[model samples]
Structures are given as structure tokens and as C-alpha cells.
Target chain A: AQTVTQSQPEMSVQEAETVTLSCTYDTSESNYYLFWYKQPPSRQMILVIRQEAYKQQNATENRFSVNFQKAAKSFSLKISDSQLGDTAMYFCAFMTHVGGSARQLTFGSGTQLTVLP
Target chain B: GAGVSQSPSNKVTEKGKDVELRCDPISGHTALYWYRQRLGQGLEFLIYFQGNSAPDKSGLPSDRFSAERTGESVSTLTIQRTQQEDSAVYLCASSLNRGSLNTGELFFGEGSRLTVL
Candidate 1:
């Protein structure tokens, strides 16, 4: 079994500033995928970014980027030029192949991010 | 639909009552997932469906929770004799299954919030 951890329960950032949410996971498998998802007040879970275990380069999507440290088992999300729209609960997830064809995602506890104006 | 859709965005029911939540995955998606998100908590995997394969019920918390997917399209999650602990946001997601290695990023629905009183 795999588990993900988010040390921060809540975070706040000012508009136009940058903030980073930390995530770590415990997995014995060498091949896997990591993801960050954002859920807003409207209850929609939106994909933020993704990182593959074999890839050395991190993933970046516009203002959202990730610092994936494979050896240390850390994958943190960085939000730049934060806006009010970024205020939401962010979750880090870990996925790996199971039973040949099954794929399961294990998620960490979320971090509530509030981007203040 | 252009995106994953979940019905009964908000459901309020008393304890001991049965509740059903529906999910319609993205067109052509071969994989569908169910997750539970309690208030101020992270997402927890509930079940998974891939094509016509037997669904993965390993993540289900108990026998009270059950889910079914017809073909590769709509899915319904049912909670029998729900408890107060059953009150949470039920999220549905879908993704393209490329192979055993890459399941691709999941696209999520707005989720169905169940409030048990």
C-alpha cells in the first residue's frame, strides 16, 4: 500500500505573490505518477499538474509548477502570481498500476490555500 | 457531455436513509473512479471500473457502500442505511486507459455533496 502526506493543513498567500504547498509520499514501487488537484468552493476538482516518476524534468502548467524530488519522495506544488481564483483546497495524489490492469490513486490530506487580495 | 457530470449536486438525507449518487463519465473514457472527500479531509478512493472488468471494491470502507457502472458510461454509488459519517462529497472521475503503465490524468466531476442529519 502507498500513502501520501501533506504537512500543511492551511496556507495563505497575497495576490501576485508565490506560494508552495508541500507533499510527500511513501511507495516501494519505482514506476508511478504524481498529481495535484484543486477543489474550489463550487466543489469541482480540477487538475493542476502531473509528474511522472521516470521523468527527471518536473511538470509545469502556466502559473503552476512542481518540484518533484524522486529520491526524497517529495512533490511540492508552486503557485506563482497567485490570484483569488487560486483559493481552494489542494490535494496531492499518487498512482500506480495494480493487479496488472487496475490503477489506483492514493491521495494525501488537503491543504486549504487562501489567496488574499 | 464535454466533461464528467455528477447528479444531485447536493443531497440532504437523514441518518439510516439510503442515498444514491450518479456519475456520467467523459465520452469514450474507458476508466471511471469514485472517491470520498469528507469535510476538511483529503480524498479517499472508494471503487474503480475499467471497461467490462470486475470493479475494484478494495477501497470501499464497508459493505454499506456499493457502486455499479453500466458498460463504460454512467455509474451510481449507493450507501445503504447511511450513517452520519457518510456525509461527505462523493467525487467521480474518468480517464483514458492507455495501458497498464499509463492511465492518463483523470478528469473529475463537480461532485455530489451528501449531508446526513
Candidate 2:
């Protein structure tokens, strides 16, 4: 069983600043996928960024990026030029590679991020 | 038609009552997922359905929680004899297909908030 851990329970960043949310996972499988999801107060879960374990290059999406260290089992999300709208509950998730009955995701406890203006 | 849609945006029921939450996945999406998010908690995997195949219900908390998907379209999660612990936001997500080592992005619904009184 794979478990994702988000050590930071809450994080705050001033507008236009940068913040990183920590995440780590326990998985024996070398092939997997990691994702960061944001859930706003409206309760809509939105994808922030994703990284494939096979790819050593980190993934970037606009202001969101992930530092994926497969060896360390750490995948942290960095948000640059943070805006107030970025305030939400961020979650780290892990899933096995494509074709399998175990395509379900394992999520971390989550980190509440507040971008203060 | 545009994205995943969940019904009963808010549900309030008494303990021991049965409640059903509905999810309409995105058109043409072959994979659907159900998750539970308790207040101040991360998303917890409940089940996953791929097309018409038997769903992976390993994440279901207990036999009391059951889900059904018809024609790989809409899915219904039923909680029999609900308990206070069942109160949470039930989220539904859909992806293009079963995620292998390489998975596609997951589009999520706004979620159905259930409150057991």
C-alpha cells in the first residue's frame, strides 16, 4: 500500500511571493505518477500539477511546479507569484502506472495554504 | 456535458438513514472515481470504475458503502444506515482512461456535501 504524507498542515504566503508545500510518499513501485490538487472553499478539486516518476525533469504549469525526487520519495509543489486565489487545501496524490486495477489514488492528509494580500 | 457533475449538492440526513449520491462523468471518459473528503482532511479514495468492468472497491470503508455505475456513465454511491462519520464532501472525478504508469489528468466535480445528523 502506498501512503502520501504532507508534513505541513498549514502554510501562508504573501501575495506575489513563493511558497512550497512538502510531500513524501512510501511506495515500492518504481513506476508511478504523482499529482498536486487544489481544493478551494467552494470544494472543487482542481489539478495543480503532475509528475511522472520515469521523467527526471520536473513538471511546470504556469505558476505551479513540482520538485520530484524519485530517490528520496519526495514530491513538493512550489507556487511562484502566489495570488490570493491560490488559497486552498492542497493535496498530494500517488497512483500506479496506467493499466491496472490499482489505478486508484492514494492522497496525503493535505496542507491548507493561504495567500495573504 | 462540459465536466463531471455531482447531484444533491448538499445532503442532510438523520443517522441510520440511507443516502445516495450521484455522479455524472465527463462525456467519453472511460474512467470514473469516487472519493470522500472529511472536514479539514484530504481526499480518501473510495472506488474506481473503468468502462463496464467490475469496479475496484478496495478503498470502500466497509460493506455499508456501495457504489454502482451504469454504462460507464453515471455512478451512484449509496451509504446504508449512515453514521455521523459518513458526513463529508463526496467528490467524483473522471479521466480519459485507466491510468497506467502514464496517466491522464483527472477532472473533478464540485462534490456533494453530506451531513449526517
Q: Please give the fraction of native interface contacts (Cα pairs under 8 Å between A and B) kept by each candidate.
A: 0.69, 0.71
Model 2: pairs clashing at backbone N, Cα or C within 3 Å? A97-B100, A97-B101, A98-B99, A98-B100, A98-B101, A99-B100
Model 2 ranges with Cα > 4 A deviation = A98-102, B98-102
- Please provide, for model 1 over B76-107, each residue's C-alpha lDDT reduced to its tens digit, 9 standing for 90 to 100: 99999999999999999988875654555889
For every candidate, the chain B TM-score is 0.93, 0.93
Q: On residues A1-117, what C-alpha lDDT tens digit does candidate 1 reach at each position? A: 899999999999999999999999999998888999998999888889998798999999999999999999999999999999999999999988544443778899999999998
**Best-matching candidate per DockQ:** 1
TM-score of A-chain in each prediction?
A: 0.95, 0.96
Evaluate model 2 with DockQ and give the value. 0.62
Report lDDT (Cα) of residue B105, candidate 1: 83
Q: Where does candidate 1 clash, by residue pair?
A: none
Question: Candidate 1 — which residues are off by over 4 angstroms?
Answer: A98-102, B100-103
What are the interface RMSDs of all the models? 2.2, 2.7
How would you encode candidate 2's per-residue C-alpha lDDT over B5-109 as one tens digit per residue?
Answer: 999999999999999999999998888999998888888889988885645788899999999989879999999999999999999998877434225568899
